[model samples]
Target chain A: MSSDAELIGRSLRGDTSAFVEVIRRHETAIGNYLARRVGRQAAEDVLGDVWVAAYESRATYDRSYPEARPWLYGVALNRLRRHWRSEPAEQPAPDLTRLAHDWDPWPAVDARVDVQAPLRRALARLKPEEREVLGLVAWEDLTVAEAGRVLDIPAGTARRLLHQARKALREAPEVAALLQVPTT
Target chain B: MDEMDLMKKLSDVPSPSPEAYDRARAVLETAVAEPVDTVVRPKRWFSWPRAGVAAVGAAAVAATVVMGVTGGSAPTGTSTEAASPVVESPLVKLASEVKAAAAQPGDSSLVIATKTAPDNSRHVYYTLYTDKGQIFTGDSTTLASSVTRNDDQATPYNAKVMAAAREAANGDVEKARIAMITAANNALGVGLDPAAADKAWADTQAEVAETFRKLGKEVPAPRPRPTGKELENRINNHLWSNATYALVVGAANTEVRAGVLKLLATIKEVTVGETDLDGQRVLTITASPDILGGNASAVLTLNADNGLPIRDEVFPAKDSPQPSKHAVVSYESSRVSLADVAAGKI
Candidate 1:
């Protein structure tokens, strides 16, 4: 049986179905990634575009790396950039209504951590690119290097950006206090 | 929350509304759609009575001759007459001229702005430029990839090379076939069925070339000319091969065809004609679609001598409800030049 990597290789050769398989495999992760960056409403609008773009551009995909997720992320990131460009510069504060719209906590583990509102406020203060790196880490669970691949930046540069962004947030007194808070 | 905790929370975020899934699904459906086949395949090309399986090649060659001879004599039917010598309708003429320019020796480039209606819903515009050997595209996607092949030569667009090659074939018929073959083998991003793609490319090129030559134009020297009936046989082979592939790949689904055509219809047809703009021999083309409703046409001015498209005036369809009623979506040069593109001149 050809591994996922082999199937990707087939797709590169002209088997579009192989590429389609890749999408079917990773769409959930990609959906989650977009939902985090652009939120649910716009995320849904842009996700299909991301998949289509990825499918259309499958020829340029660098297959040395087996997992197609990073490349798919790159496509999703580009769509997000265009979407951001079309929207107004001063984005509205991420309110509870917005957060609740996209996310709901798992009631059994930990209820009522309303800290997301404050986090969103702080996130709004960051540069768009900075927010991207932060979201990839804190939302997408991407390693710095993987995120770098997705962003089409060098791993070292991604690490540096992550370090700077982390330091800035860690030093923010409110975030620092939140960091210190022990969960039950 | 720690970064990991936050990351987990972000990943698990729920969609805000039910409509999100529907919208995403629509894009996915559009993404999977294909063009060309959507226009019911006329029992054969334009539905000329089917030539025998063995004589299809000879038949296509004969058809080309008949078409050429019949050009002036055939009673004017649906073919739109040239607007006027003074009024100057040059879109088809420019398309031919550009095809000729692409054929000349040294590397040449031109930019084309394409819009397609995947369905009746919306029209998407993409500005694409190509050096005779490579193409650079910008539109819905950010990466500059090949419309032909996935090879290293493809650069930003290695992924969709095969599809691009097929599209090129549909556009110019001759040139696109050659380029598509090159893409099938060399394009890097995806694995192409090289044997099938290569055979298809070679056969289609020869068949189209023969058709063109029989119509009385000089056979522009192909790299390695295949034999006479070889062209005919190849085209037939290709059609059957493609048909087989489509059938096996399941291209019969009507929704897929309808969706793709609907998308293609959204792109207004652009017709370029020779004219004077700023003291230059410019080809001015107007883009419009019948159904998009009111002023969905854009007038573009290109350098006629060199076939470079420069300026664009986008007007709302006469029925447009949008505010900028009849306005121009502009460009910087007569043709989309690669040098200018590299400098972000667009």
Candidate 2:
């Protein structure tokens, strides 16, 4: 099977089907990324939007990095930002309110860490763009450079934002305490 | 915890309902399958007679202007008392009303008249209402026409013209009705033109029906009607009618909304404000995104009077700015609720 980079190269060379392959590979990850920011419902709309947009602007896809996952994440992030801004200010904030609702991990690892409340509090305090950068890195497991690529920013800038975001999170009493407890 | 673990939480965030992907994919495929003519070429369709009349009116206004310039007897059309609120510029008045409408919600009503100069173009009056349940009752110039959701789908009635248009394999009448309905249903009622779209849809339908009819005997079985969201999306999105473009742009359906949201993400900021057209108040929302080569802003404006979208203007953006690119969108209603019709309410 061709790697994602090879598929992207094929897509840029006019193979639209190859692009679909790219979408199929990352659609779930993109969907999860959006759902984390906006709730599940809005996330669906956002996910489709990201796909359509990425497909439409595929001509500008920089082939330097054949793996399009970071690029796709970037497109999805921009869409998420726009959706948030278009909404009336009074509407519910981004679903980053991650309060650890009824979520159970398979294999039942009982880490009774109520880290969600503090995480939510810290997230709310960060600038909108900062939260985006931090969330992409931490939650999406994107490296600083990958996070930067997703946000259309320089990798160094992304690293700075991540560092600043961590500093801020650490300063928060709730989040600081949670950070002290090691993850099993 | 370290950043990696925190980031891992993002994986836990559930994906959106699968239906949304279905809807979005359907919308994008529709958008992709149908080519949208976003070039807003200026339309000069005024009839010769209307042009002559406008010339005369312009001459009279000009004469008054010259007289005022020369400090002549207070100018002919200038009655200070008449120039008061009663004679305020329709656009300005509409702007105020639009501002008011933006603040309120749930079952509001307004009536506004609009004009498209180069008078050959149709002029329509849209009256729109949003019920407490968010069910919108929308109608246009003629009272017999209106549109509302019936059976979770938009149905038109007293709709001989619409039915005939449909039977004729031209979806113009319904398209026109929906354009108007979309305009009327919006909080900032904007007008739309379904003529070009109707023509295109009609042509496609006729072509399809003709092809099927020609193949009738040769094929062992007739083609079945398209069913399910996938097929519906295929057909609906395939219709490259101009009106469909406006409809998709103006209305907030699941597919269209997804497309619009995607478009918005590529941009930096939007310029949304109030304006007026032909004595109707309108709230205009324009966006100048980083996309589009930074050439132009896609402007969507709605008339506040009846909560219908009246216009969509794609003009030059900050770079190479000019009002050269323009297209007019207008709509008419085909059906209304029984309660509204009984009350003689549009």
- Top candidate when judged by TM-score against the true structure: 1
- Model 2, residue B223: what's the lDDT? 26
Candidate 1 local Cα displacement, residue B50, angstroms: 38
Model 1: per-residue Cα lDDT over B213-321, one tens digit each: 5434455434332233333222222322222112111111221111212222122243445668778898665544231222254455656664344554545456544
Off by over 4 Å in 2: A3-14, A88-115, A181-184, B1-11, B35-346
Q: Report the Cα lDDT for residue B63, model 1.
A: 34
Candidate 2 C-alpha lDDT tens digits along B1-346: 5644654553475567767766655544422322111001011111111111121122322221111110111111111111111122333344333333333322333333244422123344443322221222223422323332221111221122122212212223233332322221111111213343334334433433443344231222322323333222222121212222322222322222222222222222344466667777765655442322234445656544533445555555555542223444454322234456435564
- Model 1 lDDT, residue B331, Cα: 36
Which structure among the candidates has the greatest DockQ?
1
- Across A49-100, the per-residue lDDT of candidate 2 in tens digits comes to 6766676555345555757888888787655544544456565534332312
Worst 10 residues of 2 chain B by lDDT: B67-76
CA lDDT of each candidate? 0.42, 0.42
